[model samples]
Target: MDTPLSVLFSSAEDEKYVLDCMAYFMILMAACTFVCLLFKDASYGRYSSSKYGFLVNAKLAWFVQELPAFLLPVCLLIWASSAKSSLLANQLLIAMYMCHYTQRSLIYPFLIRGGKPTPFLPFFLAVVFCTYNGYMQIRYLSHYADYPADWVTNPCFIAALSWFVAGSALWLLGWLINLHSDHILRNLRGPGESGYKIPRGGMFEYVSAANYFGEITEWAGFAVAGQSVHSAAFAIFTAVVLSSRAFSHHKWYLAKFEDYPKTRKALIPFLV
Candidate 1:
């Protein structure tokens, strides 16, 4: 029979195995997104060229796709026991993640105005990603991660705390920018008016894809705050995917409008 120590060691090995799998999965996901970008932009927004196999309402798609990330993490936190340590820091980190997804899945989707239909393939991919990512993040934080009891007083924690606060501010700023930019795009047409227009005001005045920039900023902040492999993986994935998306949108705008703003960058403020 396995002793208690053997069982503990086995559990640690299992956690390590799961983490390794998640890392590999993230790498593969990033590779696939990069390879696909070389051929065609994502099949959403102005880039939807060929018809997809299936379609769903954009609002419903967003809610359903993002729900797993929020709900799964919460479920994990509720059920998993911390790894023989006080999990104050981990709980805080989880809260921050939950805050973003709560707004995204439960609230923001419902507030969308005149959203375009989303394809089932991308929607389903998002669902899988959310489940995978959510479980990885929450599982690590809730059960595997541990900090020293005096970590708050440690120099490293102090530094990380600064980053956490700064990241939180950046996240809030990005959220505001994204929300306002989307609002601008949604209001571009009203009551039978159809077609895209050059978005102006706010960050849209500077960058073609202000919303993408905001989301990138938000994730960067998240990485800084969490300071974990999982968070860094997520941030890198966001940057890779959204940067390509922004480039595509920028190119589309330039092609569509002869008088497109020459000064506007693709994803950055001035230089991209």
Candidate 2:
């Protein structure tokens, strides 16, 4: 259990109840965010607007906002009860979580070029989300989550997949897709140019929101591997949030590009 909230939960059951409540809270917030975004786009990136408070440097915003997700899990592991933190499965799960955030918070920000400043309110909200989700994920894994002994090594099928190997595989695939998609977007503009251009190659050939698709795949995989309500909620929340952003991007492209592929969809390839 997280030491700061030790007083709030007297027993394992109490801790679970608190976690469940937090998950529910996230879902409620998701609902509200979805409705709000329907009326107006989020105030960041290309949608950056002065209405959402002063802007912050995009790289700085991303780094600071995403840092908590990486930092808190480490703290959770260090402070966790030895019985929970010592499990190989738990360590692997945490590693999977860190793999994404480390790239987002540390690596991705620096790779950005000529990115617009992010509005302050959105940055603050991102920080809160990272902290909330970081605690929900790592705390559960470190102190509450359990797994079957054979989950990691079960060989009942396909030489190695009676376990949850499929989920891990999906996570890795999604990570690679995300990297590739980002690369495509970054190279869309030539040196000294300052306007948006149609992203080509890779999955962008199919969908306007290829990067969003990649990220959604990632957390969906995490949810599958973790097999916990917390993971599921996170996955669902991610889908709601990103799908809306994807819709916005798709809408923007249609408006901005007169020759935008009429056949190309928003987030999904054909169905969306």
Candidate 3:
């Protein structure tokens, strides 16, 4: 009695196992992020603190975050250039994780701008989980799964490429919007300013958290590029988490500033 469920499960035990592992890893990552945020809040002692002053040093924080991201891409390129299918998959997975690490490592610190350093414990845990899970994803892709190199040349590949390109363009545009907005906000604050302020202009005009919007877009692009269930799951998780953050930020902006832009929505622009 082979039920459909049984058949589906039986056919790809390894893929299922990999997916399960990834799911668990995502859950762990989410937990780690939450814990880090909690620690950050406790250490910073609320968002109202004027002692450390508001506004972390953007340049310094950016440098810290960018270091790993820069290095990881180089590693990915080297790995990707090699012809082994398993290694290629592994490299792709590593590249995905590295992309994420680069973003989290580089972006969050500078974005804080003067809060207590996000609790090191949670941050450290996240790093560990990402590193480990990323390794596993790569290992499975390289060693366990076999995919065609011309996977990219198939019709599915063409479609996936289209999605990837479109998604990537949107993602980059979102990033630019966020980056420019951040620049504007930073300049507005001047030197030695502390505390979060309502971000104005750019996508901030439409959404309270443009930077987050961009971040989500970036990962969504990756998911599109991969065109796999695993990639889609990661992107979905990222979107949900980031969207929540965007909502929270939006509410905070509305509460904190009388002059906060009225036109902008929370996570979506003029929609949600």
Each model's lDDT comes to: 0.78, 0.84, 0.55
lDDT of 3 by residue, 1-272 (tens): 22122244444565558556775667566666665554344222133244433433344434453454445344444453334433443455445556556655666455644434433433443345444445434434443444556553467667655665575565556556556765655555657877666666677778877777877776676666555555555666667666766766777778889988787798778897
**Candidate 3 structure lDDT:** 0.55
Candidate 1 residue 10 C-alpha distance from true site, Å:
5.0
**Candidate with more favorable, higher lDDT: 1 or 3:** 1
- Write the residue-wise lDDT of candidate 1 on 43-158 in tens digits: 86555433764777888988999999999876666655555325556666677678889988899888777667887777778899899888777776666665555554567678
Clashing pairs in 1: none
Residue 202 of model 2 has an lDDT of 85
How do the predictions measure up, each by TM-score? Answer: 0.87, 0.92, 0.63
Worst 10 residues of 1 by lDDT: 1-10
TM-score of 3: 0.63
Please give the lDDT score at residue 174 for candidate 3.
54
lDDT of 2 by residue, 213-251 (tens): 998988888888777888888988998999999998998
